[model samples]
Structure formats: C-alpha cells, structure tokens
Target chain A: MSLLRLRRASLSYPAGGGSVEVLRDVDLTIRRGEFVTVLGRSGAGKTSLLNLAAGFVAPSSGAVEVDGRPVTGPGADRAVVFQDDALLPWLDASENVAFPLRLKGAGRAERLERAAALLRLVGLEGHERKNLWELSGGQRQRLGIARAIAAEPEFLLMDEPLGALDAMTRDRMQELLLKVWRASGAGALLITHSVEEALFLGTRVVVMEPRPGRIGLDEGLDFSARFLEGVPARALKAEPAFIAARERLIAAIHAEEAA
Target chain B: MTVSATNLPERAASRFPSGGRPALPAAFLRRLPVFAALFTLTAVFGLWWIASARGWAPPVFLPSPDRVWKAAQIAADTGYASATLGQHAAASLGRVMAALLVTLLIAVPAGFVLALSPVGRGLLDPLIEFIRPLPPLAYLPLVIIWFGIGEGSKILVISVAMFAPIAISTAFGVGSASESQVRAARSFGASRFQTLRHVLLPAALPSIISGVRIALGAGWTTLVASELVAASRGLGYMIQSAAQFLVTDMVIVGILAISLFAFGFEILFRLIERFWLPWSRRR
Candidate 1:
C-alpha cells in the first residue's frame, strides 16, 4: 500500500493580478520501503510538490493523501528534512535531536536516551553537547536527518537534503541516507537536481518538467538493491548498467528542458 | 603553488639577544584601554581637587571631594532629612526594581501577542508609538496627581519609562525569529504554543535580555526625575533638597551615589547575560 499518494495535485500562486500555476496535474505515490527520487530544474516546482506532500502547502486542485487519508496540514506522521538543516541555534545537538520527543511529552531521561541513540546512529557520538554553531555543515545535516526520524514518522519527505554538501561529503551522505532509510523502514520522497544521486539512491525516479510544472517521466530501477546486495557505491556507479541509467535520466531531463 | 612569505618560519631576533623580552610590554600594551580609563578618571579627580583647592569655584557651588566625602559620612551617621544616605538609595532602588519587574511581566507577554497576531499589533502599535516618544518626566505631573506623592506614583512613572523599550524590543525579537527554524519546528508537528516555547522564545531571548538592559537604564533615569519633582526620600530628592539649601557637598554625594548604583546594575545585567544566555554571546 502507498504510504503517501498525490492524486492530480495542482498548485497556483497569486502573481500580480492573475494566478500563476506552479504545479499541474501531478500524480505520484511512495510505497512502504521505497526510495523515490524526484529530478527537476530550478523552476520545476519540486519544492512545491514536496510541500504539498508534507501538507505545508495545500493543493489548489485535487488532493494529497497519506495512508489513505487526505493531508490537511503538517503532522508528525510525515517528517521533512530541509536543505538548510534548520537546527535551532539556541539548542545543543542533543537537545535538537530530542525536540520532537520532548514535544511528545516523553520523560527527560527517556528523550535524552533516545536522542543519544539517534545521534550515534547519525555517527555523531560524543558530540551531543556541541552547540549548533560548533557543528560542521554535514554534521548539522545528519542532525537534521536524526531529528526527522526521531519521531518515527511513516514517511520522510526530503527537499534537496544534500544539495549544500561538497562532492566527498555528498557521496558519504548518500550512503548514510540509504542506511538510515533501510534502518527506519520508512518510505522516502527526495527531490534533487543531481541525476547521479537520483540514479544512485532511488528505487524509483520521477522527472519533473518546468513551465507549468508536471511529471515528465517515471522509471523503476534496481541500483539501490544492487548497492544493498554488497556492491560498493563506487563500483556500482562505475558499472555500465549504472552509467546507462544515469545517462537515461540526464537525457530525459534535457529532453524535457528542450520540450 | 608559490610559497608565501607569511608561511615562512621566523628567524631568531637579533635585537632582543634572548629571543624577545618585549612580550611583557606587548601584553601590557594590549591592556592599554584599562590604563587609559584609569588615567582619565585620575585626571578628572586631580582637576576637581585643583579647582576646589585654588578656589576656582566657590565652596557654595563646587565643594571639594573631601567635603563631599565628609557630607557622606555625616549623612551616614547623623542622617540627612531624618533618613540616612542608605535609606534614600534603597528607596530609589526599590522603586526602580518594582517598576522594572512589573513592566517585564506585562510587556514581554504583550510583546509576544503583538508580534504573533496581526490584530493585536494593529490595535496596540499606535498607542505604544504615541506613548514611547513622550519623555517619562512629561507624565510625572499627571502620575503624581493621580497616585499622589506615594510609592504608587513613583513606580508608575518608572514603569511608564520602561514599558516601551521592553515591549518594542521583545516584539522585534519575535518578529525576527528565523523563518527556517519556525518552519522546521512546524514540520515536526509543533503546535503554536510548542513553537512559541521551544523555538520563538529561545530565539527571542537575546533581544529580550538586551531590551531589559535598555529598560533598566531608562527606568533608573525616570526614577531619579520623578523623585526630584516630588518625594520625601530617594537619591534624587536628597540631591534636589541639598541643591535648594546650597549644600553643594550633599548634592555631589547624592549624584555620585546614583552613578555608582547605576554602574553596579549595568555590571549585574552583563553578568546575568553572560551566565544565563551563554549561547547568545558572540565569540
């Protein structure tokens, strides 16, 4: 069954006197344990689509559903990892990770224990007391992911989660992301402009087109499964099949741009 | 890549003979501001002493520092106007404290409301603007008429002086809370109250603290002004009464006491800011 479903969702914003459509007739589904990657250009409304799924923004037409119910507003059931890694500066790393549990009325010891475990999962052990400014960018993003999953949400909606990282850090983060996704057992819908990342991490990839943004292509692949099956990411990416798949995604994106 | 001169290791210093002996003086030079401030204070004291000793100004107008000290001693032992210097200072401090506490309790919450709600802001913005610009002394007459030469009027005057800065800065703090932080909290299903407590309040805290500091200074100033106009006790009343009788030494003692107390409060607030909100402190 689909963990999150968007049925012909459309969004428009009031631009000057008239309305400007940002997303048009977009339909997608994220099933349990699936890693879905969305590829789009800058103005393709990828964020708008993610916002619709997360219920941060309501659709102007059609509906966004999660577990067979319509999404009205943001809920703990669908946690989002933002590109900016919005950890509160006033909070230390551990406190930031424990915030969701704190909101849920968990006891101090319980929440702290859970936050410590989550921090360890994100490979930030012994850095629990570090202030937000003390954390490196990649560590902050990892903290963001840890915070997202601390609530044990059914779906993780990520918007360009690794967009700000350097090449080496981005590669490491992608591997870590897959590991976290498998451990949490939650469906993910991540939006990115990187074709390599989309091919590397996603079980299913969707391409979005701009100028009244809509889904351009949807394809299923097995690279993530192969990577899970003891194939290292470097070896997997260097394989002919992986290269062909990456080319196909890139070609699709470029073709959509031309269209 | 070319090696830069900055990256090169330093050679042995020929001028020092034993590495560098200037380290001590360099360290002292780094503390130049402290010495400069001390020197400036000493010079001012020397000038005051010279002026009085040379009879540059009559004793009725500008009494010597020893005369002021003698007046302080006399006030401490015999009491001035039936109360000691301590009583006057305590009264002034009490009024400022009460007014500050009351202002903080009311204004901080009202500030949050005004910042969070458009309707609250629209309704209160004009009234706050109107009252904020009017000097605290301008309202002293009306306050005295309403509450009469009691503690009520004095505290009210100080409270009025403090309210605007505290409220406005708090509102600004809330308004300037990071949009991304609030959005992240909301995405985690944080309710309005939860957002306020967990995100908005902490984010606004630094600004709120700064507001309190500003309000303290304003409140202290207003307290003195109000006391000068109408009061049996307080440093301002003591100074005003002494000036009326041409007791220059007593007036200088009262003025110095007020300055000392204000300086002490400023240091106390700085210490509180450092200890309580360490994260807000700049590196």
Candidate 2:
C-alpha cells in the first residue's frame, strides 16, 4: 500500500487583496520505503508541498494523507529536516536529538540511549554534549538530521537539508543520508532544486513547474545500482542513465518555462 | 621566490607550556594583585583619616573611616535605629527579594501572553503604556491610602517599581525571536504551545535574565524610597533616623550596607546566568 499520498491538492496564500495560488491540482503517491524527490525551480512551491505533508499547513482544497490517515496537524509520525539547520540553540546535540522522544514522554535513560545511537549514526557520537552554537554549520545540520531521524518517523520530509553546506560537506551528507535511508527503509519526500541530487538519491523524481505549481513530469527509476549501499554517488552521476535522466528533467523544466 | 621569516620568541609564547598541567598557584596569586586592591582602599582611608585629623573636613559631615568602623561595630553590637544592623539589612533584602519574586511571577506570563496573542496585546498595551512611564513613587499616595503605610505598602512600592521593566523586556524578547525558529519548530510537528516552550522561551531567556537584573537594581533603589515614607525598620529607616540625630557614622554604615547588597545581588545573578546558560559564556 502507498505510505503517503497527496490528491488534487491546492495551496493558496493571501497576497495584496486577493489570494495567490502556490500549488494547484497536485497529485502524488509514494509506496512504502520508496524515496521520492520533488525537483523544481526556486519559486515552484516545492517547500509548500513539503509543508503540507509535514502538517505545518493544510491543503486549501484537497487531502494530504500519510500512512492511511489524513494529516490534520503535525504529529510524531512525520518529521522534518529543514535547510537552515534548525537545531535549538539552547539544547546540546543529545537533547536536540531527543526532543521528539522527550515530547512523547520517554524516560531520560531510554531517550538518552536512543539519542546517543542516532548521534553515532550521523557520525556525531563524541559531539553529543556540544551546544548547537559551538558546532560548525555542517555539524549542526548533521545534528538536525539526527534529530529528525531519531524518532524513526515513517516518513522523513527534507527541505533541501544540505543547501547550506559547502561542496565537501554537502557531498558527505548526501552519502550519509542515502546510507541511512537504505538501512532504515523509511520513506522520504526530498525537496530540492538540484537535478543531480534528485537523480542520485530518489527512486522516482517529480518535476514541478513554477507559479501555479503542478507536476510537469514524473519518471520512475527502480534500478538497484542508482541508490545501492557502498556505491559512490559520483559513479552513479557518471552513468549514462543518470545523464539521460538529468537531460530529460532539464528539458521538461524548460518546456514548462516556455509554456 | 621570497624567503619567509619566523619569530622564535612569538612561536614559543604561542605554544602551550609543557607538562600540560595548570600554572603554579603562586604564579596565579601573584597575577591577582590582592595587595593592590587592599592598598587602594587603605590609601583612601588614610586620606580620610588625615583630613579628619587636620580638621579640613567636618567630622559630623564626613566621619573618619575609623569612626565609621567603630559606629558600625557598635551598631552590630546593639542595634541601628530600632533594630540591629543585621535586622535592618535583612528587612531591606527580604522586601527586595519578595517584591522581585512577585514581579517575576506576574510579569513573565503577562509579557508572553501580550507578545504572543494579538488580542492580549490589544487589551493590555494601553494600560501597560500608561503605567510604564509613571514612577512607582507616583503610586505612593494610593499605596498609603490602600495599604496604610506598612509592610504591604513597602512591598507594593518595590513591586510597582519592578513590574514594568520585567514585563516590557520579556515582551520585547519574546517578540524578537526570529520567525525562522518558529517556522522550523512547526515543521517538526510541534504544536503552538510546544513551539513556545521549546523555541520561544529559551530564545528569549538571555533578554529575560537581563530584565531581571535591571528589575533587581530598580528594586534595590526603591527599597530605601519605600522605607523613607512607610517603614520603621530597614536600612533607609536607619539612615534617616541617624541623620536626624547627627549620627553620621551610622548613616554611612547604612549606605554602605545597601551598596554592598546591590553589588552582591549583581554578582549572584551573574553566577546563576553562567551556570544555567553555559552556551552564552563566550570568553
């Protein structure tokens, strides 16, 4: 069964005197354990779609269903990793990772153990006691990922989680995320502007058009080599299929722009 | 190609000392200059003692340091004004602490409500603005009429003095937390209350602590003002009564006690800030 689905959803925001439509008639589905990436331009309402899925905002006209339930408000079932590394400044790495579990009323020992394990997963084992302010930008974002994944949410929503990292760190985070995702077998809806990232990490890629945003194209790639464990991402990018997929997405985006 | 030069002395100084142990206690103590502080205080006292000996300054107007010390010892032995020196100092401190506690309890929640909820702000902003600029002493007449020049009046005076700054700073701090933090919290499935608890409150803490510090200083200043009008027991009462009787030594002692209390409270608050908000300890 599909783990998450968005059906003919429309999202609008108040602007000037009237409403500005951000997303219109958007339909999407992700099977359990499938990784999907929503690729779009800067103003293509990709973040709005992720927000709707995260239950931060509700669809104006349609339904956002997650794991067989209609998403009304945010719940622990869906966790978000934001682009700007939104680890709480007052909390150290361990406490930040344990926030969801803490809110769920888990005991200190249990949450601390779980948090320590998650920190290790993110290669931040020794830095668990470090405050968010003391960390480098890349470390903070890695901690953000740990916080999001600590709860083992069924669906992890990432909104350009590596956008702020420099090239070296970004490459490392991308590798780390793919490894974590495969090992955990959790579903993800990654929102990104990078065609390379979409091609590399996603089982399927959906291209979104600008303005009254709608899916411009959708392509499936269930081939095992693209997102397998122990496969370097650069090798995948160098593949002929990967280059073809990238060209196809660029053509679709340009067509949407011309139209 | 140009040759680069290196400074051996500068590099040696920059390197960590060998053995990786803390510096010797004697070396650290020498750097502290305990004697310098003592010498400065003693020089001031010597100048005052000389002036009194020469009759260059009136003894009653500015008592000799020795005379002030003697007067303090006597007051400590017996009592200053109506109570002992300890009793008077305790009374003033107790009032300030009680008033501060009450002000914090009331202002923090009110400030958060006002800043978070628009309707709350709309209802309270006018009253807050009206009361903010009026000196707490301006309420002295009302306080006397309502509480009848007793402990209640005194506490009310300090509470009134303390409340506005605490509330205003809290409101400003709550309002000043970046919208991005709020948005990020919401994205993580946090409810409105959870977002406030997890994100808003912690982000506003430094400002709120500063507000408390300011309120404490204000509270101390108003302690004597309140006692002057209403109290029969406190440092202000001791100073006022001593002045009436031309006990210049006792008045100086009372003034010194109040100054000491204020300084102590400031240091205590700094220590608490350091302990609880360790992330803010930059250097």
Q: Model 1, range B112-204, lDDT digits (tens) per residue?
A: 988999999998899889889889878888888888977888898899889988898899888767776787788788998999998888878
lDDT of each: 0.87, 0.81
True-vs-predicted CA distance for residue A138, candidate 1, Å:
1.3
Worst 10 residues of 2 chain A by lDDT: A222-231
Clash pairs of candidate 2?
none
- Most DockQ-accurate candidate: 1
lDDT of 2 by residue, B29-75 (tens): 45444555678879997898899888898899989888899999988
Docking class of 2: acceptable
The true-versus-predicted C-alpha distance at residue B248 of model 2, in Å, is: 3.2
Per-residue lDDT of A91-113 in model 2, one digit per residue for the tens?
88898888878767789898889
> What lDDT score goes with residue A27 in model 1?
93
Question: Candidate 1 regions off by >4 Å?
Answer: B1-30
The lowest-lDDT stretch of 10 consecutive residues in candidate 2 chain B is B1-10
